[model samples]
Target: MARPVWSGTLTFGLVSLPVQMFTATDSHTVRFHQLQRGTSDRVRNKRVNERTGEEVPLDEVVKAFDDGDEYVLVEPEELDDIAPGRSRTLEITGFVDLRDVEPIFFDRTYFLGPKGKEYTKVYALLEKALGEAGAAGIATFVMRNHQYLVAVRAEAGLLTLHTLHWADEIRDPRREIDNLPGRTKVTDRELKMARQLVDTLRIDWKPEDFHDTYQERVTALIEAKRTGKSVEKAEPPAESTNVVDLMDALRASVDRAKKPSDQPSGHGGKKRANSGDTSPPTHIRDAAAKRRSGGGGRRKGGGAGSSKGASLDTLTKAELYRRATEASVPGRSSMNRGELVDALRGARQHRATS
Candidate 1:
């Protein structure tokens, strides 16, 4: 079992349970260290006085609040003295329906566990009650010198705490978004087709059915580079069909969804070929056929003419990136200009032989 990051008492009106909080999630992103080019020296960051150009010691640093014409310096000891005193307690104010809280307000989540063997019974009781009621407790607590408004609920047989954003922190989208679709007319036929398309595509919610292809590709690229193996650029994706008619597009979508597709749905990819879709209008059908016939050929976005012998040294980073995108080069997003050149060249060579 992993050790909890926080240990505190969770309290209601009169009941209190000794609980510990564990992180619910972790990021799987690839990380890199800064280094000087053409050398193995690691890059170092130093805090220095702006005017004197001298490195400053960590102990000498003091946080300051900026005013219009002056700055007010604050000491760590002073902040500690005035910080919220309920650091060891998570006091629940009230219980409310979980659905009443919007998802946008959620920031981070943590798993709440019983601190000791004696608290297990009480913890289970609270979890059961919350699960049955479909409610969560709203509470305020201080952690790491910062106060947070949070919701506590039961999930997956464990009590969970989710930090929520303050009301003033959430911005109204309407203020920034222009030309809102206040009212739009939709014909019965269009609505019916849209619903049919949704129904045809709907399936049981399965979290395991999806995987992060981009991250996988990135990992592959890193491994290949380390092993001194060749990298291949992927073919550019197809352009979506541009239809002016809403009803026609929905119908076509429904027909496309019904057919088996090679592209992964998890990555938002569509069918590569509509093998037997004939329900669409004659023009649409002709366009689909043309797309299928030219599937193996160069796409407009793929930079098709850049073959194996093409010189990548003279190309700009953006052009190299485009070629990498076409070839589905893994971890290409993070590669530097020189790395991209090397990867693109290797990809082209691999494609020529295969």
Candidate 2:
């Protein structure tokens, strides 16, 4: 069982409910240790005094604010003395519609559970009330000497507390960003094409359909190096679209989007066949044979097929990369535009011959 990070009494108006807060998320990122360049010795960091050149214990380290001419030192106990007294209490000052809160303000999340079985009824009642009202309780409390602005709301029959950033903490993008395209005008045709492209690429929001491909590649690279094998390098990013080619680019993108992807939807490729059926079905094998023998009818434009009159040279580098991926071309990632075109041409000729 997981332990609670905090135990406190949540209060709003005259009602008080005892609750325990548990962290709601965990990170699965891979971590690496620092080491010497040519040796296996681990490199570590230590707090040290500049004047004495000696390592200092954590308890002896004090925070110091640099003034123009002097340093103002503060002890850990001094900070504790100035912390708010409501450290063990989460008092909701007011409730507001959940939609009123911007996504940028929300930070970390914690699950709030009843402290004891006897408090379950009160907890459930509050959760139900919040859910029905579509509101979040605004609260402020201190934890580990830091005061946090938080929102408490009902989620899936339980109370969830989300830490929020102070209003001033959010940066004004208009002021901070220098290259924003403010008041840029677009032609009606361009806007229509852009909307068409968006519609063509529309997909349902399914978080499970996505994976950390970069992290997976990193793991693959590590394993490949461990086994004395070479790993494929990631392809270079495509060039930015020129303003003169904006319409053409949008049209091409829309056309590409309309075509079904040759790659798998999620991380991995096609599912493995069952043990009973080790080989592909008869129709699949016949289709493969037809493709290899060039007996299938000529595919239309924008397909990876090397049918008569299909021009691989006219396709963009990104398009060529896609075709290379579908054809399982070797060293496609590190190939340039011309090289990709040549490689695709070679692959097509080889397919036709074999």
Candidate 3:
């Protein structure tokens, strides 16, 4: 079993329960070591006295605050002494509807479990109540000498705690961002076409259908380099759309989205003939033929390109991303608009030759 990161007593009103919190997620990003350029020697970092130019032991290190001229040093024990009982207790102030809390306030999540078998009944009761009420318990607790605001709620028959950002920490977007589009206007025709495009492209939510394609490519790059092979360079991003041709772009997008099979399978790349699907549907082949025959002309904001042509350059980043997803292009997730177009073009050429 995995070890819990924190163990503490959770109290709400007259009820108290002992619980252990475990990390709910893990990262799979590739890490690289720092090394000297053109040399095999590894680079390392060390704590050293700047004045004396000598390495300092970790035990001798103390927290310090710079008061303009001089540094105020303080021991770790001094900070702990000031924390009081917050380090061991998680007291819930009250329960509130989970939907009321904005998503921006939420941060890290942790799984909560009863500390022992004896406390299972109490844990189950709380979990049931939270689930039925669709509410979360707001609480404040101290861990590792830092305080955090958290929300405790039931998830998949168990309790989960999510760290929340303090109200003052969230920045106002209107104030932070420049050139805000407060009230943009659009024609009814353009709006209708946009709605049609949206309807055509709507899909069921399936998180398993997506993945960290960029990381997968990073791993592949490492393997290829290890084998003395060259990696392919990605294409540049697409140009911004011209608002003058918004309706044409929307119409073209809707036409493309109508053919769901044009999108790539979840397995990445085209489906194999052995999978009992020999080729695309008749309608898809007809549409591709039509596009190839110059029936699909370039518009100001349209990315409508035939599989055999340079029209891919006219497509927006979002359009390119969709096409990349359909073609199962590797590393598409991390790619900019230009990269997506380049990858899609490469995929098309590969399919044609094969």
lDDT by residue (1-354, candidate 2, tens digit) is 789998889999999999999999987677889999999999999998999989999988788999989999988778777766547889999999999999999999999999999999999999999999999999998888789999999999999999999999999999999999999999999999999977766665545444555666678778999999987665444455557667756766665444444455333432211111111122233344454567756456423333336478665555566666566666554455667789888988999999
The 10-residue segment of model 3 with minimum total lDDT is 271-280
- Candidate 2's error at 348, in angstroms? 15
Candidate 1 backbone overlaps, count = 4
Candidates in order have lDDT scores of 0.73, 0.75, 0.75
Model 2 alpha-carbon drift over 4 Å, by segment: 261-354
1-354 in candidate 3: lDDT tens per residue?
Answer: 999999999999999999999999999999999999999999999999999999999999999999999999988778777774648888999999999999999999999999999999999999999999999999998889888899999999999999999999999999999888789887899888888876665665555545665676689789989999987643344334457545545655566555544755555433211211112232243444445576755434433333433378765455466567667776555565557678887998999999
Q: Which candidate order results from sorting by lDDT in descending order?
A: 3, 2, 1
CA-only RMSD, every prediction: 9.7, 10.6, 7.9
Whole-model lDDT, model 1: 0.73
Which portions of model 1 show Cα errors greater than 4 Å? Answer: 234-245, 260-354
lDDT tens readout by residue for model 1, 1-354: 888888889999899999999998888888888999999999989999999999999999998899978999999777767756547889999999999999999999999999999999999999999999999999998887788999999898999999999999999888978877768677798789989998776665545444554566678799999999976553343345554445556765676556433333333443221111123243344445545567445435433333334468765454565556556666554565677788877887998999
Say which prediction, candidate 1 or candidate 3, comes out ahead on lDDT: 3
| Residue 175's lDDT in candidate 3 | 93
